[model samples]
Target: MKSKLLLSWWNDLRLKNKLMILYFVAVFIPIALTNTIFYTMTANYVRTEKIKDLKLSLEGNKDNFRKTIDSIISFSTVIYTDGSLVGALDHTYGSEAEVLTAYSEVLNPSINRFVPMNKQFYNAYLYTDNTTLIHSGMLNFIDRETEQQDWYRATVAPSRSRKWMIYTHSQPDPSYISVIRELDFYKLYSTYRKILKIDILPEYLQNTLFDQTFPGKLYLLNPQGDIVYSSEENLPQRLSDTVQQDMTVIFSVFDGVDYLQGWQIAGVYPNSVIERSLLDSRKFIVYLTLANFIFPSLLILGFTRSLSKRLGLLFKGIRWVQNQRFDLLKTERANDEIGQLTEEFNKMTTRIDGLIHDVYIAELNRRQAQFNALQSQINPHYLYNTLDAVRMSCVTKGEEETAHMIKLLGRGFRRSLSWEQDMIPLQEELEFVMDYLEIQQFRYGQRLLHNLEVDERVLDIPIPKMSILPLVENACIHGIEHLECQGTITVLAVQSGTEAHIQVQDNGIGIEPNRLVQLLGSLESSRSMESYADGKHVGLKNVHARLKWHFADDFKLSITSDHSMGTTVEIKIPVSLQSSDDDIEGGIHAC
Candidate 1:
């Protein structure tokens, strides 16, 4: 049912409209669908890839941070195992100077060597309860206040099994994640009581924990969720409150148990940065969409218009042929289907024109032969007998002018018999009419006057024989023949741009307006063989029809007359119809 409706709609549309619809369907729709799918899949892929990349970078930074803590633990363990440091801490000095010598040799040398060797270290200190044994790197007198410190109590606690604890030290310099260990190696009672503290620089710890590749705030929290370090310098100390406020925020946490137990690194990435990265991808998608859809759409539109324009020309040619206007030719410039169709149309018009020409010439010849037969068989013998007797009698009475009129009459009758030529030069046709007018002048005497003004350049133009002469005769017979005063007839032919204008003007009794209109209407409507040979205005009709058919309607004949004034007949034909010198000479021979 849908197919039937679509087919009906398609049939109702014009060819160009149908082509545009098809182009949108076949070309544009698929492109749009493909771009939509590609953009969707690409966005998914890019988001997934970005998340994976961020995860990898965060993991790599965590590994470096864990390694730094492990290195600090390893250095503290090495310092703890040193026999010299342990012996020095356990020694009972004989004097203060002796104690200073032992401390300077063992404690100061060991701590200074390690502190200067590592940029990650802030300082190292050995705290002891022996006030009399003073050393450069050791806290010489441990008081009750120092014993209350967190690192000091954590290190000295008897039940503490853990070898390392992260704590801050403020003595020589503030330190982040300081490793502290109690120094107790003697089994018997001993006076020396000490603790070792290895300090780590906060800057080094931050550099190890955070990565520039991961664009966001990173927090290093202890096992109890206290933020010990953060990438954002201006961030508040309480990170849990910040995370809880905005639910849209996405973050990841890594617990550090393999290397530095009870530590967690949390990374929070801002949505704006992710959105900005996606915006870049969206821009890329838009560019791809334009390249994929817009450019091809323009190309398709151009192709569709070019096809429709050529088809439109073909349709116009068909319409012209249907209207019987085959003279306007179609040009085929391409070797495509439409061009081939145009070529076929041009060939058909040419064939039709050839057929029309052949038929028109054959009909004209047949009509001429029929007219000649009718005249000769019906009235010629009697007319010749009557005219010859009158001519001889006039000669016998010494009326030379009357005899000359008879001779002119005979010449006219004979010239009318020759119907072999269809076209004649303007020069010869005018001469034929002038001879006939001279005969009429003999009868009218001074009452009839005529003038012929023809351009020399147009004299040799080949027009249909008897085309203008008939108009001249009509002007004289119907217009000037019954005038009271001297009636004047003028024939003019001159070039008017690309056309030749030939006019016959008479100053005599003119036709009534209505009659003139009716006569012209008859000439316009009359195209049949019967109308050409039968009407009272048959000569004019024949001239008009012949000029129209010969010149493909390029020639026009106009008749204008005013009652009691005059009548004028004008003919305009294209200059292209003018014969060349050779054609003019051939036309003369034919005439």
Candidate 2:
């Protein structure tokens, strides 16, 4: 055998593994060295660093913008704190007036001028709790949820000391901030407190960082996620777009509210400025990286001349396999390790070729014997043929009971050989078993009971025919056949996604756990079993083998039992491996 193997191995066209491994490394390594491990990684690093630097500069600009905006708020607060303006502004809170009379004596002309200087600051409204707009530089106020929050409402509510807070308008803008001042009107009016509000716009926020030095806009966001100030000429546009939308940041203290609110100010540097800054650095680093990577990889490739030659020969051998020429590998390489491997491979193929022929013959003989044994092993065929003749004679003599038994047997046989197929639609297969159960019921009377539960949706699904019946028959004969009292069989078919599963259960004596393990072992180990009388569970073993033949590991068969609760045999077939809905009826197509 060893001499014949070596001789056969000499002629095979397959390449040995050592050459293929070298070929794979040659093809994959240089590409990764140039693109992934070297060039792309460096580019990614440079881009990340550029973005980080730009973000830091933007933060610096934003702080300056916020301080400048705070200047306007501080200035307004000073005027409101003064003895004269405070009295007039304070009276508006908690009063039910639509507009409070600003006595000409108490009016500071400069303070009035401050409210109209910018478009963002133009519309200021002060509201008292009793539905009064005591001060207005804008339009009419509407009745709506004030978007008041716990901390915000508390700050602006009338109190003994001072309450100061601000919120933006319901409408959004990047260049405006709304300021609210709480009033102490509850003592004077004895009913409620009111809030004093003002809108501050973009120009008031123009500080050193918001000046011409920065590349992008600066912004202030109010507690309600509304943009109230920006340094951009297109401030409103940027606020409406992604930049402001992305900045509705929730701080660490966002547990109680949907979102926490306050005045959040920001400055954005234009993307073009930073991108231009990186161009020369980008070019210098890119060239240096390519220089570092390409030269070394090229040198390595040049030095590995033997590896390249071996791979080229291996490629030629693969091309031969692709064309299905499994014979006679002609090579210039002498009998080194590659030649020895090639010799061993050729012998492996010749052995498989011979084994395939022998296995096919063995399978044919087994099927022939299986057919012969199945026929001769059961005495019911002779009993059925004689019973039918006697039943016809009884029918001629006008005995109805004998005629009924003959009819039931006829129906059983008709369904058993339906289309002479091994598999049929699940609906039809159940009908076949139910027909046989009728014959048994006639013989044994009400002592035999059967329950079948099947999902209606799975009716047209195809399954292995006669497969379910053998288990039920085994339950009836091998299990409960001794009991003269009562016995039950339950056949269940359930559909789970792509699997069409069938279960046959009977309330009879079940096999012990150890014996069941052995039974399963015999079915799984090999296809060739000696005989049906192998003291194993023959019918179940056959079903397991057929399922394996059709679906391989994609199919599943399991049995679970109780000595009192009977045995359940279940089959699972994967959806992807199933045949087409049209072809599933008549043929078993295994891919």
Query: Per-residue alpha-carbon lDDT of model 1 for 1-591, expressed as tens digits?
Result: 999999898899997688778877987788788878988897778777777766676677777877777777777787777778877777777798888788679877877677777845456778777666764544545788887877777777787777667764434332256777766644254567777777677877777777676687777776666667777765445676566433223334545354356666666666565566688788988888788777777887898788887878778888887887886444647898887777888998989988989999999997997688777654655666678889899999999998889977866765665656666788988988888899989978999999999999888887877788888889888998888889998999999888889999998899997898789888877777666555478778777777765676788899888888999999998766744454332322111
Can you give the TM-score per candidate against the true fold?
0.43, 0.38
lDDT of each: 0.75, 0.59
Off by over 4 Å in 1: 13-17, 32-71, 87-113, 116-120, 127-137, 140-162, 168-175, 184-194, 203-226, 238-257, 262-295, 317-329, 333-591
Q: Give the per-residue lDDT of model 2 (tens digit) for 1-591.
A: 998897676545343443444544764455446655554566557667866665566666555545544655665566545655445544444544323345344543535556555445334544544443333443223234453544355554456243455544434444344556654434454344435566555454554446675555655565555555555555453345745432322212122322223445554544555556657766876676667567765665564565556556655655665675555455564587766655555565455556767999999997997697677635556656766787789899999876877877766654543334555677887887887787778867777899999999788765665667777777887666766568888888888988878888777777778877776777676466564556556766666666665566877888887755577888887644444443333332211
Kindly give the stretch of ten consecutive residues in candidate 1 with the minimal lDDT sum: 582-591
